[model samples]
Target: MQSLMRVVRSASALWPFYLAVVLFSSVVAGLGMAAPFIIREATDTIVDTVSYGTPAPTRTIVFLALALFAAEAASAVFSNVSGYLGDVMVARIRQILSTRYYAKLLALPQRYFDNQITGTIIARLDRSIANVTQFIQSFANSFLPMLLQVAAVLAVTTYYYWPLTILLLLLFPLYTWLTALTSRRWQKLERRKNAEIDAANGRFAEVIGQVKVTKSYVAEVRELDSFGTHYGETVALTRPQSRWWHSMDSVRGTAMTAIFLGIYLILFLRTLHGHLTIGEMVMLLQMVTMTRQPVHMMSWIVDSAQRAVAGSRDYFRVMDETVEPTANRELVAAIETTGAPELTVIQHSPLDAREPVIGFEHVTFEYSPGEPVLRDVTFRAREGEKIALVGESGGGKSTVVNLLLGLYPVEQGRLTVCGRDVADLGVEDLRASTGVVFQDSTLFSGTIRDNIAYGKPDATDEEIIEVAQRANAHDFILKFKDGYDTVIGERGVRLSGGQRQRIAVARAMLKDAPILVLDEATSALDTKAERAVQAGLDELMKNRTTIMIAHRLSTIADVDTIITLRDGRIDEVGSPAELASSGGIYSELLRLTASSSAADRARLKAFGFRVRDDEAKDS
Candidate 1:
């Protein structure tokens, strides 16, 4: 309601439509009362007088009939004006919410997004906010119209007969009390139902997102059956929900029926006493019946309100979430100062960085509060280093990369990029220095050129092609019918794994950041593409400090340094040759790679390559 009112106040200039509503509502009420008067008068002049041997005036009755029609037409015109205003206000609200939602989305830090469900984040615009449009329309048009109609009926009915009007008025408090109690109960259930719906939406989206993996593992039916069970459970809760709603409706209907009969009984008694005309009694009955309609419409009102309230609660849940505060300092200054002692005077977090480049300084991090993922991670890749980070899965290697990029906060130490402390840097400032390519590279539906140039939105065809060539993505891109202009499906489903990886690399290359972190950049690539991309990555790494994460040992053999991470701690650190000779974790990893290479060669022997184990290792 506060949000709806805010929208109304923002569009206060449209209050004229509200005024028109009031004017027309009054016309409706006036006409509504006048029609009964015409009926009573016509009966008196014709039927009753005929029974008593008197005459009727046809002309006056016709004029009053026309007057009633005109009043109704006038009411419709005003209703339409109100509707137009409601639509206009709702349209404004849609624009306003969309702008605010997107702004908040872009402004929030990576941690918030990381913890949130992807489908939830994607669905925020529709789920809780969908009812906002209806709320604006109903609150303005229906709310006032209903209220005014009730008031008009009370006043008009009282003028004709105060006793009955007072009796009718007395029931309103009782009715409202029951509605309030019932609404309180149903709204709680509605809130729970909506929350569960969001949870289900998130879970369902997660399952579908990995449908390919599920298919490979043959878990498709099991996943779908689980979704079905969740749906059934969600439906089970609605039974109690419906019971409360029907209970309210039953109470309201029973009370109204008893009240209606009682009102008529009084009228019949009064008529028998010669205190009221038959026509007058009939008119009063019609008024009572008309009053029941809005009362009957109570269910609609409560249901709409309940849904709207639920939506508001959900939207506010996200909107009310707090983000990490950026400290008041220049982030780059703190980072540069650590390496160049003379430069350390100020401090800044990621939100306030001077460059997109990132640095890690004895930074340790953990997803859980006490279980550290990376321990005292200290590495510096000068601007443009072709760095590789290779370790077993969950070896804290990715954690180091994430911390260096400021995706996760350094729990025990500091991370600086472009010489500024990431903790104090502004988010945009931190982002300006780097582009990340993940093992599961993501691409959206767009032309190949657009996806490649996503990192640098203004990149020209020449620059995009150059980056693509460097990433070894140009040939595959040309395979599409439109080549650079061909649109890819969602997440680049039209492309193979190698193609996607290359494009992701090209994106990072085109971003042309001064620092690079390769977190399994070539995990899914063929050897041909891997070698080509390796060359590109080496060129990108030149003059830059890099931290790389590679799973395939052959990929990182020539890297500057290979640090073996065991659990959350470093187990070995040296060049691949040095570590291999030490007979440590790196040595084991290199031996495993050699074995795999031999197996690949034997598998390819049918092609008549006749490749030996040593020859394969050299290749």
Candidate 2:
């Protein structure tokens, strides 16, 4: 009923198969419930013939045997068909649950995805699915069939021997109430036990995933000790929960066995008193035999049902979540505004009137409630403008780029892309207009051609190759075992960092968006790769609004304008040459670097002084 609704709803889509299943169950129940009557008939007929040594009873027994065989065959067919349908239903539920989970995973906020543990997600997917699967296959297949059979047995017993039926009715309620009371505690304990198991699973997953790092740092003993400590806690928590569940089961079973003994005694006494015939006694005995299995099985199934019901509730919670980035459909005003006091500007080129590319109208944003990440930042990147954001480690450069990509919303100012505020443009439209190349080489497992074409799924072979060539990656790609068709391992792990970054650039080149965001794109590359990628970058930036977030100041010496940022505020913005000439923050950073380099050279010079001359060896 809970999270399992999705699986049920999905399974419901195959109602024809399930309806047949229900009908089959009904037939099986009918056959099973009638088996006792047939047994009783056979027993009484044999006993009557034996009492007088009567002849000519063979034909009657044959007819009864034939009827029983027919019922057995029909019931077997019903059972087989029901089983097939059960499998089909389970498969469908698994598929739907898996599909919806994947969709939900993608829809969750990026920040949320980054924070949640990988192991925890995996455990939820595995355990929740098992819960839904058990409910579908076990509950529907076993529980429903047993319930129908129980009803049939009760009816037949009550019709023939009303006294035993009356006894059963009285005793059944007593056990049911007791079982129900104990079951509540069992269910509560089950929830606690499952949570503890998942937590332990998460801890184990973390250790295994980072085992390489743990060993490299020589922290294996520490990790092992931590694991043992947490495992002990998990065991401690689980023991009580397990004890509670097992205690309930034990109590229910003892009470049920006592009740069954009483019923057997009453039936045997009634037979001796002649109040019940031999046939009725046999029938009642057979009914008891048939019903014992279900009663025992029901106790275990009840625990499963409680777990499934809870699991189903949790699964639906995720499916029903609307984490997609969309709000009211109202259009935001697009007027530009002035910057705050901390936002300094000098010799900054405004957005070209003809192009009207990207404009920041005093954008003020904060990752936290009080700490502003980007404070009233204002800038306009015109077409073909290669604007560089240079700042200290915590400066909000990356945040600004994320804002342009519409990954986050601007809190106090409007950001316009091609004259429409980013909020007004919609996420899909904004993404369509931008291509990003980040410092990390985000490559997928695929052939060179496949990876390149990911930027535009429908790109042709020639087109894909052309984009790779443009990004200076085509030559290296040709050296693979199968060239463009070669399968790169997952995340292109087999490739060098530089090669991966070049592939990323090729992907962006294939996209060819009007705006490009290069967040230290060359940082991961070696000097040779950097040189190769620089030429490609120059061409890629041609006629596009470029926003580059750079850490190394020397690399962006010729950047169109260096915006010196400090603590979410812009300290200065000017040409690299101008800023150097001005002796401001940029000049100070350059001087500091120059002094450090001189000291390094001086140290090296002293170390080499005695080693540089052949006269030292001659002396």
Candidate 3:
């Protein structure tokens, strides 16, 4: 009900159209009632003339028939106009809702998405829009017009048959009672069916997304059985719901027909007794039929309202979500007060544009209260320095990158980039100053050119070619007959792991931000692919403040500094050689790598690490 009211309030802009539809419907209804009156007059005129031993004139009968036709013709035209206007009003409301809903979805915080299934979210949104539309349409085309018709019929009937008007008033309560009872049960069925469908869709989408994993684990038969179970549950719920809906419709339809017949029988008996004329009986029958329509529509209108209310609650829940602080005036003002350069641009500046490009000063954060993900994490990287963060899986490696990107809020202390506090920087400004390549590279469904141009929408062809060349993606891009124009399937499924990583590097290169975050960038690839991608990474890292988060220590062997994290705290930070020689956390990790294989030992030796030959031999 609250959702329905919200939808109505949102559609207040179309009040003028509503007014016009109401007026048109009233006019149509009035004209429609005129037909019965014309028939009443024609019948009386013919009967009176013939009963008095005089023949009824052909012209009089023809004139009455033409009058009835004119009334019907006017009614039809106005009804169509009313219907057209009502449709326009509904469409305008839908357009308004769609725009606001989509904007809300985009502005919502990442956590909202993380906690929801993509398919279920989509289905809920679709149903919300449909519910609002159905309710508005039902009210306009069915309920409101039916009310007007009822009022018009009562006004006319009360003048000639006052007792009949009283009876109609009394019967309304009985009809309302019946509709209420049926609608309650029907609404329950509808709500259950909706939940079943959403659950089924969410499960189905989850399964489809993990199809590769299922195949790898040889769980195809299990997955098929799971899907079948979900389908069966949905079918089981839907069958009963549908049966209830049809049964309620049948009850309403049967009651209405029986009531109308009873009313007709009473009127027929009245005419036979000479208490009512043949013409009056015809007029009364027409009014009863008009009244019956609204009475019959009551059940359907209430049912639609119930469905709408159920879906709307979930929809508005999303619209009311709290969004991340994309840009805050107070935060910006605080940063400006520090006398640092204002971070106004939403794109990367040249290499000499800023210094102390990325830093964390005793910063702390957590996803849940009382559970810190990072604590006292202080680090800084000057312009053109390549800093690497290496740690176990649960360590605060990814958390650091997330903070730098402002995906999560900084709860304590400060993080700075380009001499401005990152906590105070607008998300757009902070991200524009940095480019990121994640472990799982995600490419949208679009052409290769489109994906590359995503970060730099207006990038020129020459600029794209230059970056692609730097990232080592140009050759493979050319191998495709469509070249840059080649269409990549969802997440670039058409491209190999190496090709996708290179394209991601090219995308980052195109952004050309002063700060680069490479999070497990090449950790998933084979040696050959990693070598190819690393070469591109080298080109991209030049003259930029690079932050590399990797599990593979070999990847960051030559970085200017290495930071080792342990239990959400920085355990060691120094030049790669200095940390490896100190026999600290970094040294122990290096020893573990040194013992993995002779190849690792040789790689450590190549990186100038002092790995004893015995360490390699023992393992």
Candidate 4:
């Protein structure tokens, strides 16, 4: 009930449409009642004329027939108009609900998405919004009119005979009680079915997205079996649920038949004894028959209401999640009063060069309780310094970058970006101060120009071209048939790895942020592609405070400082040359890389790392 009321409140802005529908439906109901009365009066008049041998009142009979036709016509017209209004209301309500849900999704923190499947989240939104909208449309068009009809029928019948009214009224409570008995169990089954459907849809989406992997592994049969199992469970659940619902329906049907039989007997006996006229008996019978529809509709309404309640519950669960914290209101107001834009352009602040551009002081973080990924990790990068983090795959290199970007909060200590503590800085401000190039070079399905200008929407054509040139992507881009206008497929699948990486580089260059983060930017490329992309990276890193995470030690040979991590704790922090001889994690990794293969040795030698022949022989 609370969920239903919440949905009502969510749509309260469109109350005028609701009011119009009610008024129109009331007229329809009133017109529907008029037909029974006209028929009864006409029948009585005809009977009187025949019994007394009077002249047939032909004009009166014709007028009564026309009146009945007019009433039916008006009722049909009003019903259609109300239905149209209900459709319009439903469309407007859907717009409102969908907009709110999307906005909430945007405001939620990244952690909320980390544990959720992309397809499952989309499924939830689709199912919940669809059910809610369906219920609103049903209520406005079907349930409301039916309710008005039932009320009018009962009121008119009561005016003619109180005993019949009592019998008609008694049928409702008994019918409702039986439906209620089945409702709880039916809803339970519905919820289970919904879960199975959501899971199946989620997996289906995942499978489609990773079809290449499935095909490569020849696991299509396995995937099909899994998908089928979910739907099969839903079918299994429906068997018993359908039986329970129909059983209750049969009982309700039997009870309704018995009560109507009693009501019919009473009407017939009264008319026979001369207590009621034939016309009155016919009128009462028609009115009672009119209620059959609304009474039957009660079951459908209950079922729809249960689905709506479940949908709203799911929707509210997402709505109630805590949104990411925002900058202080007072601070925002102060900035607004000064007429400065909410998001300042990324440029160096007026802080002294001595202050760190990025700092993590005694920070600790964990994705789960009692298992820290970064512990007491402290580091800093001063203005115009290029710092590199080197470690094994799970040694918290990416977590450091994540913390600096405010993707996750620092739990034990402070993290500062641009000399302001991250806790006090707005997340948007912190992220806007840096440009990131990840390992995958994530790109959307759009034209090359769109991807390049994604970071700075207002960038001009010349600016985009300049960044592309700087990133060494201009020559290859022009090789395409459409140049910059060429539409790249999803994730830039149409582009080669080198082409995508260079495009990503150009995107970051166009942003022109003061700070840059390169997370294994060239780690996945072949040697030739790595050299090409590394050239772009070198150019992009110029004059910017850069933080790099590199598994390949040679990539950081020229960096001003190298910080090595061992088991989430900083093991060494020094210049590349210093770390090379520090005999710590960084040196060990260098020795390992140097002796991996002749190709690795050649690559490291080209990057100016010393590789003795003895180390190669030792391997």
TM-score of every candidate relative to the true structure: 0.82, 0.86, 0.87, 0.90
Task: Please provide, for model 4 over 1-619, each residue's C-alpha lDDT reduced to its tens digit, 9 standing for 90 to 100.
Answer: 7998887677677788879999998988889889889999998888889889889999999999999999999999999999999999888877766666666676677789898888888898899888888988888887788778779888987887788889999889999899889999998999999999889999999999879899999999999999999999999999999999989999999999999998999999999998877788888889899888878887787777888899989898987787778633333332223121234444332333235788899998998899999999998888889999877667898899888777778889888887888788777677778899998999989999999999887889999999999999999999999999999999898999999999999999998877899988987887789889999999999988999987565677789999888789998999978987789877766766656676766655443334334534543
Single out the weakest 10-residue window by summed lDDT for candidate 4: 332-341
Question: What TM-score does model 4 achieve against the real structure?
Answer: 0.90
Model 2: CA > 4 A from native: 1-12, 166-215, 220-232, 327-355, 597-619
Which prediction has the highest lDDT against the true structure?
Answer: 4
Q: Could you tally the backbone clashes for each prediction?
A: 37, 6, 0, 0
Determine the C-alpha RMSD for candidate 2 after optimal superposition of all C-alphas. 9.2
In candidate 1, stretches whose alpha carbon ends up further than 4 angstroms from where it belongs are 1-56, 113-116, 120-125, 135-143, 180-192, 267-283, 326-358, 570-574, 582-584, 595-616
lDDT of 1 by residue, 1-619 (tens): 5754544453454466556656655555555556666666665556666688655566876876777677667767766766676666567556555555554564455778768888766665686567766765675666656666667778767877787787777567767777887887787877676666666677778878877889899998887787677667768878998898888778987887787777778888987788878777777677776677777676677677667766766666655565445421333222112121123332221232233345556767778778878887666544544455555567777777766665655668777787777777665566656567787889989988889878677788999999888887888788778999988888999888778878888898887666667777775676776677777666666665567776555567668777777777777767766887898766655455455565744533322222234534774
lDDT of 2 by residue, 1-619 (tens): 4445545654455677668778878888898776777777888888888887878588888888888888888888887778888887777667656665765675555565656677777787788788878877986677777778877877877887776676666555765776688766766766666666667678779878657678899998987777677667767866886787678778878877887888899889988998877888988888876677778886677667777876776566555655546421211100011111122222212222234578877788887689899888887777777788866666788888888877777779888886667776656667778889898867888777788877687788888888778888889988887988888877787788778877888888888788889988876566677778877777777778788875445356666877766777777888888888676666765544444355643532332211112222222
A best-first ranking of the candidates according to their lDDT comes to: 4, 3, 2, 1
Q: Global CA lDDT of candidate 3, please?
A: 0.78
Q: How accurate is candidate 4 locally (lDDT)?
A: 0.84
Decreasing TM-score order of the candidates? 4, 3, 2, 1
lDDT of 1 at 95: 59
The list of candidate 3 runs beyond 4 A from truth reads 182-189, 238-262, 269-275, 327-355, 597-619
